[model samples]
Target: MTISAFQDYLNEHRDRLLADLVEACSIPSVSGQMDACEQMAAWVEARLQRLGASVTRWETEGGPPIIWGVLGEGSASILSYSHYDVQPADPLDLWQSPPFEPSVREGKLYARGVSDDKGDLMARIHAVEMYQALHGTLPLVFKFFVEGEEEVGSPHLAPVAQAHADELKSDGCLWEAGEVDEHGRYTMYLGVKGIQYLELRVRGADTDLHSAYAPMVINPAWRLVQALNTIKAPDDRITIDGFMEHVRPPTPAEEALVERIPFDGQALRSRWGLRSWLNDMDDREALRQFVFAPTCTICGLRSGFIDAGTKTVLPSQAFVKLDFRLVPDLTPELVVELLRAHLDRRGFHDIEIVPLSSLSSSKADPESPFVRKVIAVATEVYGHEPVVYPSHGGSGPMYPLASGLGMDSVTVGVGYTGSNLHAPNENIRLEDYFNNVLFLARLLQSYAGA
Candidate 1:
């Protein structure tokens, strides 16, 4: 099918397609809300049904359902991975309108999961309808692997993937979504960093003690701080014993890709109300560090007397939530091993380490044929060359479905720079949403040789 034909079909059904998106986004499928997730999954299943696809609902003991559907007909098959679950629409008062009630203002659609994933998910679904209407049935096998628990680390996805490994086999995968940068350039990511989220705890006396006995009574808060110091230096280096030894430096090709990425550090600093980046790194260095560096961050901390009024007492418990972003060679299990050893070697065995969630790092060959094809089609459809990232700094469950399944994946979505993902006032540009529909349709045509 011609691009204009696709464009005309989109133009004809623009309102209806957008209404479908709004309807999908209307479901408050916040991760962990199984009922809402089921509703959203059913919404997706019905669309697949309309396309005459056979759908399967994979359910486990405690996690949300994994919706799998297959449609189209061709020698080649492609997998599209997305999640109906979204981050909680927290701090509710910050939203101009209700989080689930999608509203359009200033050419942008605002709602809680709109830009993050729902928009991308519906875009792919609508693409099938658009293609089938303009052409006949799709010229390629279209597979949908929409899961319901991505926001909470996708803890169940790994096992679900192994259980249904045969059904997931595909040529390549289109990851959740890509972005349109501030310069109006469409961007794609080949891989994502892995993550290890855990918590550290320390204890002092059995209960709160009067500060007057401070000479003898231990403060767990103070003890926790001392232990945390051993992990990272003031220079921001991860000083955990032997932790840096596991990091794998970027390849020459990856470095070349980073060099092509656009950076505006001053603008960022202005926007964030910061004088400079950590250690005063320049734009290029900051960007490189973002994509290549593994981070040890303290996400949250809780101790005694955090309330407004001061209390002169020592508490018995203290804990801190830690998030470690991993790079190549840094598996979540490996991190746990190294951390346990580090704390033990430092004679801080009393400090407890609680493992929360783990995700393995995954990457694909940027020069792969499937990747090259997607990029070419993106450039053709978006009228701009797509900026290719060798690996995104963010963490995701892409490992289980992409590299874990021996398939390359690319992230090209209906998101933009101001999408406000995982934050209040999340939104997506209507133009980008419509363009994504056209882009996915063309991608199918290119893959199927239609």
Candidate 2:
């Protein structure tokens, strides 16, 4: 179980791993694209079977199946979570190459799902393969759980995990999508924020009316804007009735962890061409908000006359897509209840609240044995101390699968700062991919022996 043996195996099989990744990425498994998702699921099932895993495809009510597999037998077991489905590669013109065609350029592999979760998935599989090759048997029991609906907020993940809790329970879970920071330091996140995505719709008239009728007719667009304005104040505080009451401030230890996190606000401001952050907060305050504060964002807005030219017509209906990033103690169900009550109380009862998708937040103790093991292995593999984030700002289904199952989860991946996740030209460095194989191998060895 030495590092050199793992490295030797990776060196010998690097090309094969890359080829497998390319094949996996070639499938256009966009979240809602059932045909492609099924194709990708079949590919995963075949691959896992080839690696001697017992595979099961769990069918969702209306979504793609979840590919679950178990391999090897050991005293300790570990669950690896990743998703095969990717975000739709829209705005195709932005891509330098086709989204599904995996291409290697400048030592990086570029594809729609290459870096987000597919690459991570492939790396873990390769790690298991390499470990078995050298040790004659896997160091620990390994479980692979790859879902196809993560890009759509994993609407059914909670129920699926609950139903299969017995099978998914493990000593620790390895989450998807970790990355190297801009400073070339590998980073790990213990948990992720929760999200509540919903849309507010309003209607005023039966159909479009001439602009001249605006003086008499109530405009739904204007009404929607007024209602949106009430949810957040000009000071960037979420004024959704009772929303702030659920946002608990970071504990003293959490604050100390935040202080340790390296942040360069100036670099971010320069990259985004911004003069300052919201409310011009100082570095510590900004970092605190970045990791702790909940957000109210308008993801999309729609109404009549939104094309190239203005159609001088009054809009009959309006809708706004909103996402609320929740902190600890704030559940998605609570968000919907509070928002509906808030809108109704503000006399905008006509505005409909349609809950799109949601999942609760997840957090792990940084000092937990599982997290400490990850930090130690990452440090050894990267040859430097890894940047540790108590919790990532993004929302994911980590809660139900990890913390909810009474397991600690840590994220690790083959991405860098410029991986362009969920955007065009998503990619990961080949070196990082190979290095992660070694990292996972060592983690498995260490965990098994512990």
Candidate 1 stretches with Cα past 4 Å from truth are: none
RMSD of 2: 2.3
Predicted structure with the largest TM-score when compared to the true one:
1
TM-score of every prediction relative to native = 0.95, 0.93
Instruction: Write the residue-wise lDDT of candidate 1 on 1-450 in tens digits.
Output: 589998898888889988989999999999988889889888888877877889999886688788889998877999999989999999999999899999999999999999878999889998888888888888889999999888887878999999888889898999987999888999989899999999999988888888887888888898899999999999999998888999999988788888988777898899999998999888899999888899999999998877888899888889999999999889999999999999999888899999998899888787788898998999899887789888898889999999899999999799999999999999999999999999999999998887
Against the true structure, candidate 2 has what lDDT?
A: 0.90
Model 2 lDDT tens row, 1-450: 579988888888788889999999999999999999999999999999999999999999999999999998877899999999999998899999999999999999999999988999999999888888888677578999999998887878889999999999998899998899999889888889999999999998899899899999989999999999999999999998888898877777667678788898899889999998888898778888879989999999999897897689999999999999998889999999999999899899899999988889998877778888888988888899888787899989999989899998999999999999989999999999999989998998888883
State the lDDT at 407 in candidate 2: 91
Residue 268 of model 2: what lDDT? 88
Can you give the lDDT of residue 429 in candidate 1? 94
